[model samples]
Target: MSTQSERIKERRKELGLTQQQVADPVGVSRVSITQWENDPSVRISGANLARLAKVLKVSTNYILNGGPSRMEEPSGQYHLENNLAAAPAMHGQVPVISWVQAGAFTEVCHVELDPEDTIWLPRPPGASEDCFALRVVGDSMVPRYNPGTLIFVDPEVQPENGDDVVARLTDSSIEEATFKRLILEPGAPKTLMAINPNWPHRFIEINGNCEIIGTVIADMNLRRR
Candidate 1:
């Protein structure tokens, strides 16, 4: 079994990329890449690890644990056999922002929020480049998403019926975005539902006033631990 540093160096060499080439995309100095490849004790941040995996054209799991390598076609499509050990597909980091920021989230607007103070988490599997994270704020999504849970939202993905989503009511006084499960019925109006049965206001009719900002792809409740 090869060490993590060995795997990184081996893969980079196979791809004919210099340390600086990998460093440029991962947003690090060439010295950092050299340390990552040469020093086993040097730990890489989750964000950098994910970015390195992408720059190397491999999965994070493959870097952490030796596995069947991923192949990228000339067309840039990534494929691995289904029977192989399942690995979490990650591209980069997603910044954790407030519900208010999430409501106003966009490729353009978020850039102004400044990247330095942002708390970035590892991007979830199958998430798009536009993915962002929001902390669960209320009890409306309880039993599944408790307050303070981190929910990754992806605007690029279309919300299907019964998908958990973050939405904003443009016509209403509600300013911050709300997290709810989207319900679409045939011929009837759509609804945003709360999972908690005891909650008094359990559903809100979409009625065209609600604009779904994004679908919840994954969530993490640190309190559960």
Candidate 2:
């Protein structure tokens, strides 16, 4: 049986791509590529798998199973890993938390308190359980997320430094969450970021330490006009 590394190397050679060329495109080291091609013990992440899929011009499932799954991207929209129509947490179930700004702030807004304070939606089949959601308010995350927009987050997943994420900072007033991409800064970790280049992504790094809410999962957005 061919190992994942061998398969990766074989595929790369078949495409006439040098290790350096591939590394430059993916922002990883050529040695890392070498290791990936040779090490059978290396387990990759979904994001890395996505990058490989694009580089190989194949589907993610193809890399995993040597073939593609029935899942297909919708005609007009991006296919989220999970569906948003699943039943949300009910009474005594997961409680829905309040909204918090990913950018720096003094106090967390506390209003419209509800019984379901920690309720989160269910994960789709074959999806991870770290998923959660937060409602959007300001235009800081506009274009990608609108006011009142419910954003799904998955903490089990780690986004690249610049990837979008939902950060949960201490509100003191209430436990709240905010979503944004990263500025790709060094050291201090921040969450709030922008998904669209048109929208400026701003993130607030903790002076000491705070919780990273979660990585964005699926989203239920209103149809654009």
The Cα local distance difference test for each model comes to 0.75, 0.53
The estimated TM-scores of all candidates read: 0.60, 0.39
Q: Could you tally the backbone clashes for each prediction?
A: 0, 13
Top of the candidates by TM-score:
1
User: Per-residue CA lDDT of candidate 1, range 127-186, in tens?
Assistant: 876678888877988898788988899888999999999998888775678899999989
lDDT of 2 by residue, 114-208 (tens): 21123334443333432335667677777877787776655567666666676655544445555667555676554455554565534455553
Task: Report the Cα RMSD per candidate.
Answer: 14.0, 16.4
Q: After superposition, which runs of candidate 1 have C-alpha atoms over 4 Å from their true positions?
A: 1-90, 106-111, 223-225
The lDDT of model 2 is: 0.53
